[model samples]
Target: MTSRALDELPSRNPTGAFRATDRADPYWGGMFATGISDGWVSASQHRRATPEQKRWSGVPASFVTDPADALAQMRTNRHRPSILGALGAVASWRTITREQLAAITGSAVMARTYPKSLSAPFSAGLLAHGHVSAGMNRLAPARDRMSMWAVGDQIDAYARYRKSLTFAEHVAVTGGQGWDAEHRFDRHNVLTTELALRVAEYCDVATVLGEKQMALPALLAAAGIEAAQADLGRKPDAGIVRRDGLVIAVETTASVGRGFRGKVAKWAQILQRHPTYELPLVVLVVDASTPSQATSAAAKNTTTAEIQAAIREAVRDYPGTALNRTADRIGMVPWPTWFPAPHEATAGFLDLTASFLARGHGRDEGWRQMRLLDPGEMPYREGTTAAGETIATNARLLAATPHWLRTGTVPRTDQYLVDQASASDIEVLSSPRVPDRMTGPGFTQSVAGRKWRHMIRLDRTHRESAA
Candidate 1:
């Protein structure tokens, strides 16, 4: 890559897929693809993620589906990558150079690559530092000292991700109002977040209608979080609502230090004044190793529980509009999962739900007659069939209604259910969900603002002092 061209890439990749940061980006994918990638987190770590990625990508094969090779070729047994290893891994694929890897990835050892093709032994592509720092030693001094921490490389993984498309175009499909809409998701993090929610197959009528955010009444009912939409003075990052219960406000932050703490403080304040009883606020701290957050101690040094405890303490002292002990009602959680195991989530986890609009039967009466199938609390489980069967069967049985299963009769195929689940930005709605606009405090606006915000219903076991 040209010096200028090489300078433009993002340093890290979206790590949501592996609960990692820039280190796990696609540019680094070549590292994994080259059979020397870190295999600390096995495919089984993301049990639901693999199937979901394959399903939404609409391709049976992708990283998630076929990770055996990468796993087998693991170069290191370290839980996380060493700095030196990362630099080398990226450079091994020409993403960075060996010298650069040595400086940052924690290696002092270095080598020079001579063009065997041309028989030249000179360093050809050594990059001059792009932005010279104020204290940088302008004079090339001979030093053999390595710092405990090194500044991370600024290779934009997103830019590289665009160049390194792996899945088929159909894999990008999402089942929003605009069923077959064009490319709405630009980032893998955004796309995967939506797909994960949808594939868990939680909502029957999950949709993105107009300028509204994503909303899934079915998931709400399943998770038991009251679902509603609201128009705050300013639009929130994301949130899920309840008509008679709590309004869970979810905010995502890729920043740490003041920015991260500020978001938590603000959301905690919102939880205090929120018009619901079970108003638990969740702040999703994105992958911590991004350029903005990687340097912050809160993101790097503090444990997730420690941060949560800090947020809880901070919220405790903040004055509330209606309730006391409001601190207990607010929560600050790590990205990938706000709470503990079995319920890990990204900030998008509750912005709204990603769901497929099941176009029933055919154009004749099919369009007019369609039912939204909910994936229930257990997303991987089979949702109700068109025949009203709760256990998911083959697509052929989609039209099977409640009577068909026990009646031992082949249900009429007229009621076909086609899955159009993928991510999209179009503000459209499935014909059925379009209805009389909901009215009330939060219900005054569209429940979904047509973005991939996540919504989570705090189940009974999870609801704590955060009410």
Candidate 2:
């Protein structure tokens, strides 16, 4: 592979870190500003203040003050706990020094934790009302390390919280759950909207490269106006109209999985009817990681290379034959494939979104569909036959391993059965005579069913039997 220096490639701003200048009030902000003070006071009082708190409330009063001196004094004091407690008491007093307050606020803003804290009240309010949805509330930890939040789990929590609170109470707490929910949805929408705008913004460039025709500069001018409008929270009026007379529909999503698969299939059908215009459909996958990497030149180049490769492959292997045909009909040619060195694929979605938005279609709905794509049917329940067989084979191999022999291992106990059984009844067998865990057929078969339950039972049972 020919390696290029990081500085060699043309640098484009991959991070859509452009702050939207439109100053319309954010729903969450309004919700928080109105509700946080009261909620904070209530939550604070509920946790009764102690004598130590009283003492800590007023001493070394400012956060900006040199705490080093106070810290040293505490350390030197024979009664360190008493001194420290007194300092804390002084600090906790509601009359925080202006300097201390400023320091605390500045730190909170930098950490992004301040927003989270402020949102708690609003979140409480939403829980009071019943407007939150189940899926939104079920945010769980992400299976992939790349994601920050278990979006499903967070959604679930938010939903549960909303269910318990009234709208007014929610507003009192933070703006309520509805506001928070809207914020989440709106962020996703804005991202998708930006993607469409990006596509529209770059239409002329694509037209030049793909069609080998000079598109009117006016198209560029229109795209710029739309981009500005999108930044202002105004949805731009744009649609995909191909030369072949087909009006391409746009969908925005935070996730792209099974839900989108159906949408894509439907779009394919629609494109079939408009044989004149090749359906020009675009999918903009918005990634939040681009800005993080874009700050460093080396990281940026590596990211760019990976993005280019992925996009090339995606376009080349685009599943829709109709879409490919449309690209050909429009005299569009794919851009030259020049991969940047030290490729990283995480930013592919961002790069693609920027490229498309720069072309001209800036206004569209953003949709988030979360699911993993499996080439074959998922091996859950009815689909488990083959997977079960594989597990069984592996389990037998594991049974013959020395670990199983030494441990006296048993395999394949169902979860429901284990759940019904007493903890003492379960046993784990670890015998030298048994094969390695992976080699045993029973071990593999157990894994096919309730693997954890089976293991736990086997372990407990073995220890009991040995005793």
Candidate 3:
């Protein structure tokens, strides 16, 4: 208790209350975190505003008074009923319709239209009437706009209707070809046009029978027109054949390679399974080519005639069963029989094939044909002529070739070596070419002249390698 002891005793701590510290309870801490003025007066004022005033006023009066405090209160009561809610309640009736809401929201608006004299239960009818009457005044272009909107709706309905058809029904409507559906060709303008016409007919029938029609006839007609444009020249060759509650159409195209042959083989197998249905596949080879001296010049040195003869001979040896039974059942028609002259043999063949597949016959009936072939100049060069110009010549050669050969045919002839006439000039033939005494030429030249020369050389080389 001496003077020394008093000096040593710690002075009363005065800064303890001002020391930085964290609160254990966040709720109470948050309450203390805000400024007293912002926490109390500003927050309370915002909570007191009328809903109508808040709704009508762009910037709320509460926020205008104390922005910071009002903001805090607004954040806290974001989900709660406020002046905006009250205003909405007062204007609820006005916003009931989609158009009314759109007007307020400044959104895209949709409305109905009808004849000027027509009346209906909804305000939509009144709007329609007003639109029609206001040609030069307030509602000018209203009917045109309405028609456009109606077209959009019609397209949507047609899509929905197409989607709603049963698989069998879809096949029947698309002329029974699976490729049409697989490739979406059935949705072409031609097909759509046909469907639209059918839909229009249905509407007519509905009207006659006093039935309610959901889609407009005008819309269907438009779709039909589009379909017609898209399916130009292309047509279904096979007719619809119904069996076991299923409808299928025969489809055919000139055999190109193993891929097409495989398709044919598969069809043949399927026909075996459903013999009662008859073969629905057909093959047509059309010649669409112009005889050109340039083409003759290009092919002059080539053994095109010999090759064609060999191919014809090979096809003649193929089993008759290889031909699609459906072709025979449906009646095979030559390309020239169905198409007019001046047609490329190849194009005419393909067209006839497609037509046969679409109509199941060679004769071009009234049914429209849709052309899916690319509309450009042909690229193949037969002789000196462009392939397009010589399509008829090449097509005839192709048609004479057997399906197996066409599908399996691979060019074994080395074009580069063939381009050079003299065997001595060909470097690739040095080791493989063997001289022939009878031909009075080198082995390579003599061997090259033989039938299936490339295949023979290839086989010989393989044999030598094995030994």
Candidate 4:
């Protein structure tokens, strides 16, 4: 961005707001001109002039439409790309919570600065509507995270710039939820979206399908499953589609909660129908320190054992070796945090995941090793090794582990693989657990469900005593 001359300033509106006119200022004037025309600035906001509110009148140092250009201008203006990425990401997701967007982009400042002091960047080819303040005519919920909705009547030309499908056919195939308004922003959806973004960042080569996309008719058809099965609501949290037509289904779960056995059976039904799809199910199990019935180390010795135990006694009376082998596809690891903290703790895990999915040899090696170890153990513990060196060496280590585990010796070139692999036991150790509190609407609903079940049990017991 270059300095603007005295003649280039946007003309002021009748109400003292600045209105952008037809000019070649791609960074500022041209991009924001539509916002003023569309009545983004409300009349009530102009009633008073606070020192903070006056900053909106100041000239922009620079603005850039292209991310590359924004990066180039980072030294002069730090907020350009962050704002650009935030705008595009929010548009792509349709309605993302502030926390979700922040976690996805790893930008705290971006999380805090939208729809309030962000009118300038908010207008970059998108309409800004506050979901929190849309009705009730009051301030947003005091404790709840405020969400912004950027999809309005206007066509979003910036949709192509967002890291999502822009074509009508592609959107239809991969799920058109991105273009629609998201009614519920629950923990499951938030974590799923975060995982998708993280996977997209590290696994740039493969196409990441979000949870909604996983249930799409086109995707299910491609996976050799019927649309009717999807209607029954059996689907993975996300998926990775490769060039070779193999789809690695990714499922994230906090536990083998109630009905997990039936859930696994439903998954098996889907998996049995589609051989091309593999369920590399990942679970967030209780931290060993936390007092729970599922904490035995023996049960968690391998991915299959852990998953089998998670699905638990429900599968015992149910027949078949088929359900038993289904555990082969599931992996369990201690939660890095009590809640999902993918941005802070899961980079290396995702990096190793990318490496495993990048090539045929690596994916094959990962599957072979999954029988013995959890997938989370692949990345060398952070700070013990260089940034990506551990990830690169982990691939070699995966191949060499079998040889060394059997013969107790590896070649000289693969010596480091043994050293790192031997010391990675600490990788599975759990993080400190905080007392679980119901903070968000999602958790509140979960608590209500628990209460409802307790009431039913009490009612049943009272009836039995009377009988």
Best first by TM-score, ranked: 4, 1, 2, 3
Model 4, residue 78: distance off in Å is 22
Between prediction 3 and prediction 4, which has the larger lDDT? 4
Instruction: For residues 1-467, write the lDDT of model 3, one tens digit per residue.
Output: 01121113231211211101110111111111111111111113323557674443222232232333322332232311121111121111111112221111122222223221111111111010111111122233433421100011111222333343322222212212211111111112112121111111211110000001111121123224232242233323221211111112223222234543444443333333332223222222222111221135444213222222222332333313432323222212222222222211233222222322222235323222332121211111111223222221211112111111112222223343434433433355544422111111011121122222342233455445544
Q: Indicate which candidate wins on TM-score.
A: 4
For all candidates, the clash counts are 48, 127, 52, 0
Instruction: Give residue 408's error in model 1 in angstroms.
Output: 25
TM-score of candidate 2 relative to the true fold: 0.23
Return the lDDT, model 4, position 59. Answer: 18
Scored by Cα lDDT, where does model 4 land? Answer: 0.33
Per-model TM-score on C-alpha atoms: 0.27, 0.23, 0.20, 0.38
Candidate lDDT (C-alpha), each? 0.26, 0.25, 0.22, 0.33
- Evaluated against the true structure, the overall lDDT of model 1 is 0.26
Off by over 4 Å in 4: 1-95, 99-112, 116-185, 203-205, 223-225, 229-232, 242-245, 259-261, 277-325, 337-467
Model 1 TM-score, 2 decimals: 0.27
Ranking by lDDT: 4, 1, 2, 3
- After superposition on all CA atoms, what RMSD does each candidate show versus the true structure? 24.1, 25.4, 38.0, 26.0
Ten-residue region with minimum lDDT total, candidate 3:
205-214
Cα lDDT of model 2 overall? 0.25
